[model samples]
Target: MVDQQWTGVRRRVVALGARADSGQVFGSLGHRWVLEDPLSAAELAELEAQTGARLPEDYRDFLTGVGAGGAGPAYGLFPVRRVQGRWRWEGDGAELADPSMLARPFPGHGPDPESLAALLAERPEEEDFDASEEFDDAVEAWDERWEAVMFAPERTAGAIVISHVGCAQREWLIVSGAHRGTIWSDCRADDTDLAPLVDDDGRPLTFAGWYTTWLEAAELTSRQ
Candidate 1:
């Protein structure tokens, strides 16, 4: 049974979700979305066991009470089964996160490059390489280290791809760790960097905040 509060939220969501398929919600941007059948309790449990990660409460509620797929921001919410295949990053080499790291908790804080700096300093120079080549080689080596830090479990860990916002931009829901339940934007994976989706107050939007905010916008826009 869905809780009273989220049941209300889900009702609003269902109303707004209908507009996604009609193309009125997004105003001819042509993004389409639809809600699928909700996942059975058994199915959700099986999904968690298979992935070794527990989902956040609100998202889990959405999946169980509302629908497992369809009718979401951007392209749409992916089915839970899609996680198995979406484990790898398609955007860039620097933001890689694999299936193995899904259960880990996301670190509350951002990247810590101090350890990476020390690790790089300990690496020995390449043997018999010319100055230019060696410099290039060293730079390449450092780049790898930098990428590692960016994608470290604390940085990119415990996150699952939730949806793609087109143009190679994507969204992830933090399933474990400190930021669990927060929605993150991966638009910068190939450019600037990953960022949390924030509200007008600059607070990172939790799953409920992100979705409800969109629903509110959709309602207001539809009225206009």
Candidate 2:
């Protein structure tokens, strides 16, 4: 049943390509979509092997059944082929430059709650510095370590950029760990941690859920 649903969405995605070929815009976001050319299954497998993680079934289906790249939320979907070489993280200093990191499991949770609370409690007080230089230095060292923990790789390990949501917002797909196949919104470009996309019921969205929503949105606009 789910396969049938995915097939329908794939058709919609294919239709977008047809429109693009005919020089027709499907929606406001249509201009942004560079409808993907189809990709071979062998190529998709190579990508999966290189990353050392199984791609989400829906996304795998999209790459082989729909298109290799292009046509998605925000700017457009990133092509797996183009992901080679170093990935420059624009928003923050953290970039998944190492492909080996993609093989690691993605962290299931965000920043640790207890650690965050502790850092908050340790806010340097003006009075603390006046007490002694030694105390101030100690406080500064503690603060630096706390900040590093806040942005540790565990926050978004085993994820790769799948799309650019414009304005430094990036959409990532988890490839490893328990969260594999989930879609996460990385607004760290806006100084925020990577967060999962949830439905009205607050359930974390899967790859299909995220991509299909964008496809449907484009279809609705095409009729307007």
Candidate 3:
């Protein structure tokens, strides 16, 4: 069950979520996700179950009052914590919590070129996406929680960082090319990727495991 404090937040969310439009971007902590509609009670329950975290307050307020997805007409431009608090317009990312935050252009915080290159070498691709599918669907996409990427749990191994959000098998996240960063699914089953940290199969990976792979690859590459 979601916390009682979140009740007001949730109710406001349920009603407000229903009215949101697609591609509605909102965020905190320099991340983002497009709002679809006000998430239903069932949807909220489902999200909680999936991420193991509760949505935050301003998030509730935004979903219920202003709006969610892409960006709120009010807060969409600045979904930062202070915007909801004393600042109201300052848009502070650090003050916000997890779960409710959305993904956005959080420069200097994600993977770097050398690390990303090392990550790629550590976790090599096992299978290419089918010709029918767009090339960008291979990268893992995370939830509102800390650094995470969703992908298939089988057929992948070594050097990859992965976590299963248990998003339905049919859902696929596209992160490259023309359809870059678009979410999709086959409707047949869960998808998989070669996104560096998660091996060829899409299983959750440990930080140590990822680091070890990078170390080994760096050692080998150094010799060359």
Candidate 4:
């Protein structure tokens, strides 16, 4: 039986790509609507073994039924591959996810709000320093502090970076915690905390919902 979750997804993506103006859509050129071959049962099992966590069901079905990655939201979904006999996802910032820590719980919150505000306020301004060298030193010092508070490895445990939205921004899929199967947006590059990707009803978006939403929009854009 076909998994209803991904029914007709591959076909619809291909159909949209066939449209002459599909490439006109934003980010279409990057993926060119090309999806990699789906993973086989053995490959999927090996991936699960390597990660030490079974992937979210919706995402797992996508890998087995649709494709491992490609032609997805933003620049496209990051593809997972085996190198040196080990499985890992490949893309900008994809390495941020540590597979060894996939089973841990994702942090429920980021740095304390008051402290983060204080840190942001302390961000150095070039005009405040008379010498460029002095300003550079100040900026570097501030950046180190910011990274320590914001980009701590523990912040993203149990999550994997699934896609990049450019500008050093990326999205994550929670794999082994209360938020498993849900997608979260990462905007730490802009000094904002990671948050769940919610739908029109303000509910969290699952992997199936996130991908299908993008696919539907792409189809609509291509036809127009």
Question: Residue 184's C-alpha lDDT in candidate 1?
Answer: 87
Taking all chains together, each candidate's TM-score versus the true structure is: 0.69, 0.70, 0.21, 0.96
Q: What is the C-alpha lDDT profile of model 4 across 1-224, one tens digit per residue?
A: 23787888999888888888999767888888899899998999999998889899989999999999999999899999889999999989999999999988877578889988999999999999999999999999999999998898899999999999989999999998889999999999998999999999999999999999998888888778
> Model 4, 125: alpha-carbon shift in Å?
2.1
lDDT of 2 by residue, 66-185 (tens): 666666766566765544542222322225424567778887676767766676677667676656786778778876776576556666678877776666667888878889898888
**Candidate achieving the largest TM-score:** 4
| Rank list by lDDT | 4, 1, 2, 3
Query: Candidate 3: which stretches are off by over 4 Å?
Result: 1-36, 72-224
Tens digits of lDDT, candidate 3, 1-224: 33243344333333334443411322211222233345455544554454343443334333334333332222322222222222111222212222222221112123345654554454424365464234333343211111233222221111111112223222222212232222222221222332322443664332223323433443343345
Q: Could you tell me the lDDT of residue 64 within candidate 3?
A: 39
- The sequence of per-residue lDDT tens digits that candidate 1 reaches over residues 77-160 is 665544453423232232445557779887655444576457656554656356877777776886676667655555667887
- Name the regions of candidate 1 deviating beyond 4 angstroms: 8-21, 27-31, 82-97, 108-154
| Of candidates 4 and 3, the better by TM-score | 4
